[model samples]
Target: MLQKFQVNLMASKLLWTIFMGLLIPTSYSVFFNTTTLLEWSLFSISSTPIMLTLILDPLGLMFSCSVLMISANVLKFSTIYMKEDKFINRFTVLVLMFVLSMNMLIFLPHLMMLLLGWDGLGIVSFILVIYYQNPKSLAAGMITALTNRIGDVMLLLAIAWTLNQGHWNILHMWMLDENMYQVLTITLAAMTKSAQMPFSSWLPAAMAAPTPVSALVHSSTLVTAGVFLLIRFYPFMSSAWWFTPLLLLTAVSTTLMAGLSATTECDMKKIIALSTLSQLGMMMAAMGMGMVHLAYFHMITHALFKALLFVCAGSFIHSHMHSQDLRWMGNLANQMPATSSCLVMANLALCGFPFMSGFYSKDMIVEASMFYQHNLLMVTLMLVAMGLTSFYSTRFSLCVVWGTNNCNPYIYLEESNPLTSPMLTLASMSVISGAIIMWVAPLKQEMMLIPMYQKLMPLILVLLGASLAWLISATKQKNESMLMQTQINHYASCMMWFLIPLSSQFPMKLPMYLSHNYLKLMDQSWLEALSGQGINSLSVKSSNILMSASKPMPVNYLMMSSMLGLMIMMVMF
Candidate 1:
C-alpha cells in the first residue's frame, strides 16, 4: 500500500512538472503570436536535407500539456480504483506507456516518425483494452486493433507515396507533384483512427477496458489521434477539392449515429463512449469546415470534461459493485456527493451549458459551421444531433435518479482521495478551462456573424431535448419509449444503424465461415479418416502380418519361400 502511494506520488509530480513546463512555453508562443519549427539535419539525400522536425507550436504543446495533466490525475485516481488488484504496478506502467505514445504523436510532425505514436496508440490501446484478459475484453481488443489496422495500412501507403518527395515532413508536402492520393489515404487513416462512419464500431466496444483507460483513450489519446493527424495535414488536405465534402459526410454521419445511439444506450460507459464519438465528429466537422483552430480548441475542452465524466463514472461504478447499467445505478448523488457533482458538471459541459468550458468551443464550432454551410438538410441534421446530445444526457440523469432495480440498499460509497481528487481537479478545469484556453491559445477570439435566431438555436435545442427526455422518463417508468418505439427502430438506433456488425463483424464473417466449413468438411471428414485413422489402421494390419510371417521365416517359412520362388520361375519359363 505504501509502495503504491509512493509510486503514484512520484509519477504524478513528474507529469505535472512536465505539463507546467510545456504550458508556460506554449502560453508564451500564443501570446507573442510566434511559431517555432526546429529541425535537425540527420543527413542529406540528393541535396535534400533529411531532417527530423519537432513542432513546439501552441497546438501541439497545449495538447501535450492537457494530456500530461490528465495523465497525472488519472494515474493518481487509478491508485485507488485498482487498489484490490494484485497487478496494480503493471497497470501503472501501461498507463505511462499510453501517455508516452500520445506525447510522441504530439511532438513529432514527420510522417515517418509519426507512426511511432500512431501505431503506438493502437498497440498500447489494444493491450490496455484487453487488460482484463476475459473473452469479452479479448474480443473488444481484436475489434479495436483490426479496425485500426486499416488506418495504419493507409498511413503506410501515404508514407510510401510521399517517399519520392525526398522528405516526409508535413511542411515539405506542399512541394509534391500530386498530393490527392496522399490526402485521400491520410483522410481515410484519420477516419479510422477517429472512429468515423463505418469505422466507428470499435469506439463503444472499447468500454471493455477499465474506466481510467477509457478516460485517457477516448478523451485525448487514441481516438483524438486522428483529429490531431488531420489538423497537422489540414492546410494541405483541405486544399483538395473533394476533402471538405468527404470529411463533412464522415463527420456528420458519425455525429448523428453516436447521438442516436447514446439516447438508447443502457450501459453507462457505452453511453459516454458514444458521446466521445459524437464529439470526435464535432471536431472532424469543424476541421471539415476549414476551422482547424476551432476543432483543436474543442478537442482540448472536450478532453477536460470527458476525462472528468469518465472519472465520475468510474466512482459510480465502483460504488455500485461494478455494475455499469443505468438501470442498476441509483442514489449516487446522495451517497457520493462530490463525485456526483463532478458528474453533473461534466454532463452539463457536454450539453454546452451557458459559458461553461464546452460552450466556448462546441457552440462556436456548431455556429460557425452552420454559418458557413448553405445546405438546409445538413443544418437541420446538425441541430438534431445537438438536440440528441442533450436528450441523452437528460435521459442518463433521469435514469440515474430513478434506478434502483439492481442496487444494494446497504452499499456504502468510497469517496476516497484517490477517487474525488481527480474528479474535482478535472471538474474544475472542465468548468473554466474554456475561457483559460481561449485566452492562452492562438485564437483569442473568433467573430462569427451568424443571425440572432440561428445563434439562439442551441439554447432552444437544449431546452426541447431536456423536455422531451423528461416526458419520456415520466411516462415510461415500467415500459420504455424512445425516439422510435418499434422493435426495429430501437435496434437500429441502439446498434448505431447496424454499423457495429457491418464494420466489425461483417468483414470477418465470410472468412471465418469458410474456415469453419473447411474444418468440418475436409479436416474432420475424409482427410482426418485417411490421414489419421485410416493410416493408423493400415499400419496396425501390416504390423500384424509381419509379426505372423517373422516366426515362420526361421524354419518352414524358408522352405516355403524357396519352393514358391522356384515354382514361379519354372512357370515363367
Candidate 2:
C-alpha cells in the first residue's frame, strides 16, 4: 500500500511538471504580447473597508511562471531524492503547500491578501526547515521562522498604517500619499526575507533542511519573496530619498559578506546557500538602484542555476553517505560524470562566465551601476562582490570537482536518472534562460559613451577572481605555511565574522534573560505569593484557626447560654 501511494504521488508531481512546462510559453505570450491587467475581487469587509484583490500583470505572470516551473522540477526531484524517507508523502504535501503560498504571494496585489501568503510562506518554511526532527533542524527552524517573522510584522504594520488610506490594494492606490514609514517598514521586511545583513544567519542555518527543500525554498520561493515584494512595491518607493542609499548599503554589505563567507565555507551545502545569499544581494542591489526589471531578470536567472547547484550538491551528499564537508569531496568528475558536469555548469553560471545565464543579467547590472552617478565606495564594493563571486565559485569547483578523491573505497559514487534528470533540465535552462529573458523582457538601458575597459569591468573582475582562486588552490597543496595562514584568515570568514553567533545569541539571550527574570520574579514569586499559593495558604490557615477555637466550646452549653442572653435582652427592650 505504501509503495503504491508513493508511485501515485510521483505521477501527480510529474503531471504538474508537464503542466508547468506548457505554462512557460503561455507566460511568455502574456509578457510580450499582452498588456491587459487581470483582476478579481474575492470579498470585501465594509467595516474596516479592506478589499481582498488579486491582480495579474506581466510582472506577476513572469514571476508566477518561474515559481511554477521551478516548483514542478523541485517536486519531481523530491520524488527520487526523498524516496527512502518514511514520510515522503508528507514532504510532498508541504512542498505543494509552499508552492501554493508562493503562488498566492505572486498573484495577490492587496496588502491584506499578500499578508496571507507571506505569513503562509513563513509558517510553512518553519515547518519544512524543522522537518528532520532533530535539534539542529529545530534551531534552524527557529532562526528561519523568527527572522521571517520580523518581515511579517513589518508587513502587518504597513497594512495597518495603509488602512488610513481607505484601501488595502496597493495597485489601486497610485495617487495615495506615500508614507516613508510604511515604505521603509516594507523594505526592511523584504530585507529580512531576502536574508540581507544582520538577518543573514538564518539562510545558512536553514541548510539543516533536506536538500530538496533547500533547492525549492532558497532558490525560487522563500528567499525571492522579499525581492518580489520590493518589485511590486517599487513604484511607491522610487522617489523616496532614503530608499536607494539604504538598500544599496544593505545589498552591498550582504553581497560582500556572503561571498567572503562562501569562500571560507567547507560545508558544500552552506557554500551553495551563501552563494544564494550573494545572488539575492545582487538582485536586491539592482532593485535598490531603481532597476526593478533588471533585478527581476537576474532573480529568474539565479533561480535556475542555484536550484541546479543545490540538487547536484544533494546528489553528491547522497552518494557520499550524507557527508557535506567539501574536504571529503574530490575528483567527483571521474566518478559521477553527470553530476560533476552539472556542478561545473552551475558554478560557471554563478561566476558570471561570459554568455552564461548569470552573465546576461549580472553584466547588465554591473554596467547599469557604472552608468549611474553613484557613490564610489558603493560601486567599488559592488565590483569587488562580483570578483568574490567568481573567486568562490572557482574555489568551490576546485574543492568539490577536481580536488583529491576522499570517498571510502566501498562507497558507490554513481549518478541516478532521478537526480541527473532535473539537473539537466535546469542546466539547459541555465544555458538559455538568460538569452531568452534578455530578448523577451529587455531592460531599457541608457546610451552612454565609455571606454572598453568600463564595459568589460565585470569580466575583468571575473578573471582576477578566478586567477586568485587558482593560485590559492594550486599553492595550498604545496605550502604548509600558506595553508596555516589561510586557516587563520578563514577563522573570521568561516565564522561569518561572528555574524551568525552574535545575531543568534543577542536576540536569543536578551529574550531568554527577560523570560527567566519574568519567571523567577513574577510567575514564581510575586504572582504565586499574591494570587495563587498565598491566597490558598491564607484561607487554609484561617479555617484551621476557626476550627481550633470552636473545638474548645461545647455546642449544647453555648446554645443554652445564648438563649438565656436573648431572653434577658428581649425583656430589656
Backbone clashes for every candidate come to 0, 0
Q: Candidate 1, which segments miss by more than 4 Å at Cα? A: 1-6, 43-50, 175-177, 401-406, 444-446, 521-551, 554-573
Per-candidate RMSD, Å: 4.6, 5.2
What's model 1's lDDT at 343? 84
- What is the Å distance of residue 332 in model 2 from its true position? 0.5
What lDDT does the true structure give each of the candidates? 0.85, 0.83
**Model 2 over residues 274-325: C-alpha lDDT tens digits?**
9999899899888878878889889999999998999899898988888998
- Superposition TM-score, candidate 2 onto the true structure: 0.89
Candidate 2: stretches off by over 4 Å: 1-4, 11-33, 42-52, 175-178, 446-448, 478-489, 529-573
Clashing pairs in 1: none
lDDT of 2 at 513: 93
Model 2, position 242, has a per-residue lDDT of: 82
lDDT of 1 by residue, 494-540 (tens): 88999988877788899999999999999888797778597677656
As for model 2, its CA RMSD to the true structure in angstroms is 5.2
lDDT of 1 at 70: 93
